[model samples]
Target: MMLTNAVLCLLIGYVGSHGRQEMFSVLVCIQTVVFVCCETVLYDAGLYRWQLFIITCVIAAYTFQRLHLSKKLPLRLSCFCMSLYLSKATIVLIEHFVFHPNKVPVYSYVTILFLVFMIIRIFVTEFDTNAHSFTGHLGLLCVSVIVNANPLIYVLSSYIFMTESAASDIAGLCSMVCGVLIIIAQSIHVPEDLRVRYTGVLGIFLGLVFIVFRPNLTPTLYSVFQWIEVFSVISFVIVMVTDSVTQFLQIMLCSAVLGLCPGFRAAIMLYPEDNIPVSGVLLFMLSSCIITCIILCFIKAQHLKHTFEKRFIKMSTMLAVVSMVAVISDISTRENHQMFLTLPSLKLILCANLVISICLKLLALRQIGELLPLTEPKDDKEVPYLPTIGNIATFISFVMICLMAPTSSFYHDVWCCGASLVLVCLQKDMRIFSSLREDNQTTATKITSLVILVTATLYRSDIWNYNSSWMFARGVTEIILVLFSIPNCYILWGLLYDNVLVLNEQIVIFTLPLNFPLILYSSSYTGWALAAAGIVSSIWMMFAKFALQPYHDDY
Candidate 1:
């Protein structure tokens, strides 16, 4: 009964909320919370079979009516919803009579049926039918199914054979990279208006990598070198193919597989545990539903039919082969499970770098979208300073990274913060000063400030051994110094560059102030309040500088 409610909620939330993906996400989160709470309560009370049937019927009826009455909803969607509800209700009835069970099994045939319906709904409602032939659609469907099923197949095959070999890992990684590269290559062929939307592909890929891949320093370094070699060859070859619809089909197949693989893996992993953990199950459902919806939304939003060159497909194939062989050779000769758990700091650094890269890419995509004439301001002096969806997303990603860093850190808080500040200052100043003929007052000021910051960072051990009064004052001074210097450096950098900080950098600049309350007072509430203030102030600054008054003639 609980699973049925989850399915109904997922469908209604997805199909009923047109042009409101955020609302759908919220609905899913709320429904999952409510259902989990209710189920926990009901489990203790011992839900009866009759009670389950009654509940399923009521939920099913409500879902059917809700979907049916949505005026803008397609007729096919209505039918699909009805069929899904009826199927669930039928499964409950059969369980009542034959199995005499209180609830359907989580991994039962009914669940498989629900997944099939969900996938078909995604394909029918989200796929661009006018963009490709029937054969193309079928090919994509097959690829999605295979990709989704791959995890389960591997798990099952493990019982019969050794499925966890380096060879298999290499093959899987090669396949994943091939799919990603193909999608990126295909994005080049999409209409200009729709091209920016493909940037979300990077987000999807990074999100999956975060969830599924465990980083190791050695393999990562090796993979990078191999990827560069393969990328160069593929780029040369893909530039030579003729543009055609068939190539588009191949690209679509790769996109579908890449987009759906994460969700499918999450869902499949849900089946293995002997006891169902409510929190785990709820989280899995939420993430999977959200990913699927986001991907579908991207697909449905594109209207133009674009064809890719045939060389893209050939290049993708050759790249896959090359990557596979390279990975296999690298992995095969190495001792099993060696270096897997080594270099914990390296892994954290890699993950942090990946997050920053994705955020930056998202920012770039937002800039591209903003450049479109439709979104461009009519007045030369006016710029759009209001935060867009992309800006909000980038901010959220940045904040998450900031919050996550402290938890993952291996060094002292003070040293870590100081080092980060120094790095940011140096990185920005080096770039700004590189083209300058000689150091000016501004440059001299920054260099001196950096030296002071570095001296304070290195004096951490000495400060700790001082008398309590002196130690407290010194700590406060250091915190004040960092809080001051970090923003000053960024502001100076921004002024020197004659450009506003990008959303991600703005996040860094603003949130740097939180170190005061966070380190000196150790108050989370204070930290949060300062962070919120910083964000709001950053937005207001952007609005004031660009929207209210012209920052520059060209801008």
Candidate 2:
């Protein structure tokens, strides 16, 4: 009865709120679990998490919009889409388990379903989008291409097997290079805007054909065809970075993965290092990173660095991904269980660079108050970010990174120094700081907040590792933290609602109802104590803002 009720409630919510993908996804997942749990039918691997996710979502579709299943045949568009995703899934599972290089993948078939819907919607939907949202969607399509390119990537990267083996002797390395170039050519356009992501399904389709034939790939150069498909995905992403809102978020998410993620398990395999020659791929990646940084430096020179910063972060982040994966590989080269070995030095260098660069960015941002002309007027939303208490909390995370891992190459250390200097001298105007009283006062307030927050972080972290197992055991501390954390999220949502209209608009335009769940779920740091802290922090901030309301007149 309980299971039935949950499914029914979930069903209504999912259909009524079809716009919210995350919630809908969650509801479907839950309903699937409940149905499977309560069923008299025996549990099998077939009805497991991944399969259940899809089966449940389909059931929900049947319950609400019966046409979804009825209109589509057994080998329907949705099924085909699901098949493509499962192909990628098979590749992922194979790669993940074989190499033991990174993370354990718990993939759901629903991801494929999501991709299928995306393809249909991209061309068919009359959805309204800001320029950013539109571009972001294209960027995501490019990402999907990368995700789907697992087999080709595996083949191209598999030089050890290809070069040493008699089977690959027929294809030859030069042939591989040519094939890749052709694919790149087909996927791209001279003018970035000329690319089309609507043909994503087509690209995937062709790539499958190419993958199947690329081994012999003789008469029509099938390998070459696959390469073009891959290129199209890449080109679409490039276009997205140049002009999408969702693209920016995608960039940020990737950065977060690079900056905070400790292992390769979760990292997207762009060009798998294993199959490709180490020297070539590394050089190619390095060259791209340098070119990207230089382009961003030019934008900084012009003082038009807002959007450019996001790009810089994304490029650096992807390269850093390769570096981080290398770091993980070094640890577990002998046994798959090598994630145990922690390198403090390399982590220190990474942590230091991230910390210093963030500081430089923050320092430069502080000068905004001094330089701004009150007469020029400013949108509250556009007010340059002055680091907040949350930022300070995140900084504690960097400190944790340094403490947890040990490694510091001279090259990596140099990155820290270079990024710091770049932050300071990145812009001629950024180098300028004023001796104004208000500036000093503002600096003091921020510093004070930072010190307090860092102290809190230090205190929490001190006991965390010591009682780490106990902490994971779940108890009063954890529950309190969870409860307290929700209010902070509420506060966060309030702030986002008031000040981040542009971001919200972009999410709304492209992401559907998922935007709301995203806002709701952004309070990821919520835990027993953390939740309490958020509630207290938000209430205090509100009170403080109320008190300071009258002072806005003076400013």
Candidate 3:
């Protein structure tokens, strides 16, 4: 039990480390689960454990210490602590009156009920953020239920029907294949007016094919649950088609009650023998889910109000996809064999990717600032030495290639070295390449060449070898390398020509092929879900690129 508590605490800390509003809400939900499990364990044992109490106090103290250092502690923490003490006192009083052997208390059941109400009041006052009106909260909860229903159906079906058959796997595969085709169709070049119609028709045809072949794809739940799921799906489709908030909320509310079913069923199954009443357990789980959903809605609202930069959004999307892949890979390999790369290696790769991306963005922004017509004139003696930055970047690339050579195939190393030499020669203004340099290639062309070169290296490295568990990690590492090179190329292009190359459709088009390797490697439902998300994102990007092309052309 101590080990379990410690692990849960660590997970809470890790997931909440980002400190984003969305993550904080997830942290609250996780902490609530941990608290419930602890209470359940204590109830079964019929004794309060001092060690657990001490652990809680220690964690609270550490949290407070950090809050003090940050000087951003909320007043709610103090209120929460006061409410905890009040609830404890109320519980003790109720126990004294109701559980005593000798006392003849008047209306003992009514007294207990009143005490419970008081406890609820204290909690609601202390914890409620009141960021949204009651109706707004209710509407967001309904939306969350609608969005989560599709995935929840699969979860319940897997447990209740135990339907881990080949058909289900085939359905997942079909969905992935269709998703990929949609992405490809969207990426194809065609007349602007016809392109939209072409992609739409292709998407509809593929979706129909998927539905026809996978007729039993949807899970057959009990009558009530099935109707609720169907209603939620229909309401969701309507919301998408019409983009009407009033209709969304009205229709979704009817199906929102279904969200409570999973938690209620789970609690009943888990605590059938417990002393707690079924209703109380159901209420606890429902409250936790509602709180989580509300937080997610708040995060979404905040995001919509304050839009992020396009590059940041793109980087975040890529990071999220990569993180999902890592998690899926970890789960799939857990029982099979040891992973090829250590946790530290994966962390290093992620950190390297993040740092390189940020650096590239900063360099591009700086270049833009310098190029602005309104910029102050610089002193001739103080002119920035751009060549030094290029040479330093080339050296770093050479070092990276050497570091990866131990794991890379001969061809991969040879290609990387050749690319490094080309970069070095470009930095040195080699006479042999003077004519090619004189042409002043566009940033898109430069980035495309680099992406293809790196991708070719990855292919030659046999990084997709799936014969062993460790091989999977190697493949992921190589993929990360390919992604890492994209930003590096952008930075390099900026340094070489003293001009920033705004990333465009070419980057997405070239990188889209990497998704196939991911699809090929994925062997689980979660992995397929991530792959589908990647494809959807690619399709969105394709449309967005086309939508914004005229603006770029005019500029």
Candidate 4:
């Protein structure tokens, strides 16, 4: 609420009569921060002072207009800010792909800093201890500023001479800034509620700047999503326990990439033909994510008396992935008699890479288990625990994506983006199948969940999109066009499912006929399958959660 008041004050101050003075001040603050980050980190993202001035003026004008309204706007301001951000980011992304093909797209300084500020605000709202929350938030902001400033310093310093080390120095400096931030932030014991809230934003930006930046880092579904769980779930615990900025940075970077599977796929598809094998490995990693989820779910289910075969689940999943790879390879090789790629070799290579990955991960998990707990309970009796159902259903949705290998055809980019947002914002107690457990509903929870789900559903349905069509039959542009079908089943499901993410009387009635083969066959097999799996999984997990409650003696 303090943060809310501060934002209101800040908003009101900008809109009031002394507009230019205050408005210009924020621009100066942003530019100064940008200059510092560029000079220090050598991350020379395009930041024209004139452009900053223009954007500042535009936003200020909009704020002034909005301030004329008597009532306060919740999503309007935030969504306005985010919509502008998405526009800028999209422009940047397009520019990166077109003009600057090699370089990763960097975000605007305002967006980055705003996210940092947002993280702090979220912590204030979620965490109980005022001192820790305030200081923790400040420390995070400080680290972001310092780290960003270092990059600016390095970039400006390199303008003197075209020396390569200067650039490397900048990149290293930026990396170091991230490292320093993590170390400092972790020094304090951040509270539990705040950690969960902060991780979603942190994980994303970190993923943008840090994790995906690694030269040799391979994209795997398991690795990427697990990384998300770290920021979304584990980071919350770490923040609560150690409160280290260093660890938090790592968690944030991880989470950012988790929801970016479609982006990652696009990246892989663009890789050189020789590196096609890498795509398979990347995909296998994605499948292995299910394995990891299965492991987590199985453990939880066993403790809670849910039935899932340990050996069979493991073997079946592996075999299914392997069999699919084999099938794809056979079809690909046969089809490639006149094409560019040898699908069979790539498939074999991918499977091999995946198997090796699983073994290595098993080894890593063996040792890392001691360093982390599976889950951290918040406020002993307040925030209900996230059951195995939520995790499993989400995994199911994800697994379907991999199984069908949905391209822009069915599970379009919008769908991927939607699901990812819902996931990263998901609470420890909320299941992907249902909504917030009544034992732990907060105002923030409703707002965050509502925004993500609504956005995701719209995106998933391709309602806001202009070129949304389904391709069912092979050759000719055969498709289903249902753009903006309002008062939709998805909305109803969201409303009903939001309260309890599992199977119950309400879910069973809605989900029963919904999951039948007829409806499933209606949409693109690949897209709808994943969507249906997500829905069905939610129901299954919820029912199973209740059934297994008697068995969970340890938890």
Report the number of the highest-lDDT candidate: 3
lDDT of each: 0.40, 0.38, 0.41, 0.40
Ranking by lDDT: 3, 1, 4, 2
TM-score of each: 0.27, 0.21, 0.21, 0.26
What tens-digit string does per-residue lDDT give for candidate 4 at 1-555?
A: 334445655664565445554454344334333433332233233334434534644574355335424233333343344334334433343334434532422543454445444443433223334665655665565455455443243444355335643333454345444544544444433434455335444534443333243322257865564345434443333433342423323333443444244324433543445545544545444544433343333223323221222332444456456547644644443433433333433433334334333332342233243332333334655532323333343434433333333455434533444444323222333333244443433423333333333333334442233343342231121122112111233433444445433323444344444334323333344434434544554465446533433434666
> Model 2, poorest ten-residue lDDT window?
259-268
Q: Which stretches of candidate 3 lie over 4 Å from their true place?
A: 1-173, 176-191, 194-394, 407-555
Question: What's the true lDDT of residue 150 in model 3?
Answer: 31
Off by over 4 Å in 4: 1-130, 133-137, 140-179, 185-267, 270-315, 318-555
Which regions of candidate 1 deviate over 4 angstroms?
A: 1-261, 267-283, 292-387, 406-555
Per-candidate alpha-carbon RMSD to the true structure = 30.1, 30.6, 30.0, 29.2
lDDT of 1 by residue, 1-555 (tens): 577667757675565556464455345444544554465457446664446745755674466446445544344454455445444545555455545554545554444344445444433334443445433543443354344333332343343345552333434443443345335434443434333234334334432342234323256764553444333333322322322212334444433333333433443453334433444334343333333223222232222112111222233334334333433433443345544222222222233233333432333343453432223223765433322222333333333333445433223333333333222211112223334322322443333334443343434422456568766666666555446435644554564344455333444445545545434442223333333434454454555543444346765
lDDT of 3 by residue, 60-123 (tens): 5455436434543444443343334333333334344434422424343333333333333332
Report the backbone clash tally of model 2.
Answer: 33
Could you tell me how far off, in angstroms, the CA of residue 552 lies in candidate 1 after the best superposition? 33
Q: Write the per-residue lDDT of candidate 2 for residues 351-459, one digit (tens) a residue.
A: 4345434543554455465542212334855533322311332344344443443334323322322322222212222113322223232332322232333233333
Give residue 14's lDDT in candidate 1 (0 to 100). 66
